[model samples]
Target: MSDLVYEILQLAGILAFAISGALVGVRRRLDLLGVVVVGAFTGVGGGIVRDMLLGVHPPVSFVHWPNLAVAIGGSLVVFFVHPGITRIRHFEVVFDAFGLGLFSANGAATALEAGQTPLTAILVGTITAIGGGVIRDVLVNTVPGVLTRELYAVSALFGAGIAVGIEGLGGDAWLASIVGGAAAIVLRLTSVARGWHLPKPRFTDERAATQE
Candidate 1:
């Protein structure tokens, strides 16, 4: 993808995630500062983690001031319009899905650009998609959504894998990004609507009691 397109996707992902995080903070009754802080974390946390793992010093989010500016803008908007925003059903899910798709594609593409292996790229992409939300949930003392939500990280993995596969096949980077992101969004939304979940192992009473 062109640098312009990549930057646009990054900004959009930051804004979407920031809005979701700010909403969560508001729901948890955090003050304005706390809401903004949560929003910033959700916007840039994943990217920071990915960059650090890739050995990119200072992280792009820090060097690119617009990323932080857009995140704070999203938080302020949520802060002022939370009443109307909260009235929208599944708002968080919708925004979170968008962020997941964009960030997953971008993250995988970035890792590949940095000469990482396909498997490592996929893992980093999944982490980039979910890391921020994990931090947000922990801040509020809630279980991270990826751990309990329907096919969350799975969706990221699928998306990242698609991006890697497309590039490996010599496809256009933009096409790979678009297809991968769309796949992630569709999978996540479908899972949510259908209440699909990964199967959990059921422990026998005897085993459970023995383990306990």
Candidate 2:
């Protein structure tokens, strides 16, 4: 994708995740400072991790003022306008889905640009999509959504795989990004609406009898 488009996607992802984190902070009854802190972490923590893993010194989120500005601005807006925002049903879920999609696509694309293999790019993209949420949930002492929620990381992986596949096939980067992101958003929303979940092993209720 073009640099401008990539930056725009990054900004959108940052704002979306920031709003979700700020909302969680408000729900947790954190003070304004705490809210902003949570918001900033949730917005940029994943990107920082991704950049660090890619060996990008200083990380883009730190050097780019607009990224931090957008994150803080999103939190400030949420702090001031939370009353109306909270009234919207599933507000957090919606924003989280958007952020997941955007981050997954952008992360995979960036990894490819950094010359990562497809599998590595997919893994990096999945991490980039969910790492911030994991941090946010840990800060609030809750289980991370990727561990318990419906297909969260799975959705990110799917999106990242699509992006990697498209790029491997010589498709346009921007088109790959859009398609990958849309795929993630659609899968995540559908899973949420339909209560789809990954299956876990269940132990048998009856125990074996002891030998005489």
Compute each candidate's TM-score over C-alphas.
Answer: 0.93, 0.93
lDDT of 1 at 21: 90
What's model 2's overall lDDT? Answer: 0.90
- Write model 1 residue lDDT over 1-212, tens digit each, in one string: 78988888889889988888988888888999999999889988888889998999989898989999999999999989988764543888898898899889888987887899999999998999998889888887899999999999999999999988998899867777778888999999999999999997676675684573
Q: Name the best candidate (by lDDT).
A: 2
Clashes of each: 0, 0
Summed over model 2, clashes come to 0
RMSD over all Cα atoms, model 2: 3.8
Q: List, residue by residue over 1-212, the lDDT tens digit for candidate 2.
A: 69888888899999999988988888898999999999889999889989998999999998999999999999999888988764433888888888899889889988987899999999999999998899889998999999999999999999999998999999877777788988999999999999999996565653433323
